[model samples]
Target: MAIDDRVGQAGSGVRRDLRDALAVLAATPRLLVALDFDGTLAPVVDDPEKARATPEASRAVERLIALADTRVALVSGRALKDLEQVAPFGDEVLLVGSHGIELRLDEADDVLALDADERQQLGVLEQVLDQMAGTLDSVWIEPKPAGFAVHTRLASERHSRVAHLVAINELKAEAPDATVRLGKDVIEFSVRSTTKGEAVEHLRRYTHASAVFYAGDDVTDEDAFVALTADDLGLKSGVGPTAADHRVAGPAEVASVLSLLATLREAHAADAPDTN
Candidate 1:
């Protein structure tokens, strides 16, 4: 079915694709599922802290975890503690926070802490962020393990652009050695090596994930998209980019995809003739 038809009908293109993907996931014993939190699992919000997973989406992922022989991971630019608070799967899902700078397999205490210089960069960033917040109205900053961000999603488009420019200049001046990056309504600065691509590579190696499915939305997620191989599934959750293997409209569509996957897993299990 076409994309429009899928929206109109219950189990169409999105549902069929999701069913196919889940069949592949269940057929393979070793499956790795990685997702970006904001704008992927949860709707993007002005107050990042207020962002929470939709009940339907959260339940879908939980069902996927329960049914499939898969290891699920939540990878985001947010700090470890912050990502945990926002993620739908919580500690049950492996956490790759701070742009994968901090990782936790099962619990927050299991988190891999940041190094010394990365820690110091946080201090340096705090000063720059404070200045940016002072200058821009309806703008704020979010501090992470190896970086800091200025968010202007709540501000007018003009102020958002201005804040982005100012934040870029200030962060560049403050941390010349650090890599500065931009995202939708946000600007970030972080240490050189802590990137989404590097995070994907590391997670793939650690998990020995023979098959992978990565879903995300945002500029930072591009790193992971590039890292994906032909056999892996790279999904872009929002508008823009024919680059991803699959394109989804928003978090609700993503949830729909996951829910269909859960249903498909059950279908496949029933179809198998053997008890094993």
Candidate 2:
């Protein structure tokens, strides 16, 4: 069920449910807070460089990180360099980029390495997508490490549909084994099949988190949502059919939710018994 829009209300049943979940997550030995950068932490924008996390959301992330047994990560479709450019965070939060094709555990971590075969495949993919965009008004190609995404966010309805159709047909003929993913106004074709779900699972094991709180706002995020289990909470940040357990209107509501989690986590930490 959809909760209150702001999540700033007091004594609402929906609020209580979310509050309880956050409390349980806080009390876990290790809690991993994973989020989609675009449309989840920041408002969706045509110019990706313009997107930045809401102030309240940024504060909440810092607060949660200060608390014991807490970790935060940004799982985004942007390339690692692109994600880092927009996200004003340091090494404090892990970053999973390119829909899990790239992972930035820390600044010192090695970059993604591709073999000769993969490099040749990427070159061909880029050329086809480049041609697709050159022939259509407002169609754009976004480069990634393993593949590229055809962005139709700026295209007219007819042009957008034509771009998608052409991309699909061309991929079937040119790169039959390429993995394709559909998102809001975009279609991504990857040489390597990877997903946000795999990234989240990897983070879970890597951090040894007892519970995971993940939020996202696109169809591709369903891959991550479906990966969630009873110990996890999946939140959808926009209007669409979703596998997420909860829904919010948009980025503003997401900020409120994160702020609430920060509050609940602080209280839970205060109440816990001392192990020492």
Candidate 3:
């Protein structure tokens, strides 16, 4: 589909859901805007370390952060340290990494700990994944504190399928208790049970937000999308079946959505009655 057509479809939801979402956000006393990093704010890249937010997305987030009673956050499946490197927007933007298992707000960093048995199982799983990667061309393993990921983004389609199957079978045999999530061209396994849904809920409570706006572009992001309530907005940045109420073609359209939200929020703030 054409980019404009996709964006139009996103903006024109069932009976103006987007419009209603924006209106609620504008009048909300406290707002929490959380976005997925990869494929939401930034395009996916071969080198994961090379990913960065698009200029438009960066500017829109900055504008949102500047608005009164508005908080902006990046929630991702990446490790906290890796996310910190990719999204270096300082302390203003909250960071939820490791698929909500790791959180960094301001200087405080909270990471979930794995018990000895879980750690041992993860280690075995990692070793098996490494062995499996050696057999498949262009397949690599990403080590994480909770577990690890098998990445096949650069592999051929057939090879990717084979590698993923092999990895899943091995993970099932070795660490059946591990939580597995499939996204794009990657399969992530974690010993801890956490989801972007829990992360968004935590942020909502932490910020005491009256309304929330979350945007993402992956299967794992469906957790965050499902977390949204009537008072919140969920945006899907790419195509495929999703729980998001709205859809945008890609990062550019996501930027436009955020920009509009920031503009509306700023106007609302300006028009609010002053208690002072």
TM-score of 2: 0.92
lDDT of 3 by residue, 1-276 (tens): 232232343333223556656766667899999999999999989999999999988988998999878999899999999999999888899999999999988676645777898888888888888988999999988988798988999999998999889888988898888888999999998888799999999999989999899999999999999999988899999889999988878998788788767766776777788755
> Model 3 lDDT vs. the true structure?
0.86
lDDT of residue 82 for candidate 1: 87
Task: Give the TM-scores of the predictions, in the order they appear.
Answer: 0.84, 0.92, 0.92
Tens-digit lDDT string for candidate 1 (41-84): 99998778899877878987897677545677888988878887
Candidate 1: residue pairs that collide? none
Pick the lDDT winner. 3
Poorest stretch of ten by lDDT in candidate 3: 1-10
Task: Give the candidates in order of TM-score, highest first.
Answer: 2, 3, 1
lDDT of 2 by residue, 107-220 (tens): 566678888877888888888889989999999998888889999999999999999999999988888878999999999999988899999999999889989999999998
lDDT of 1: 0.75
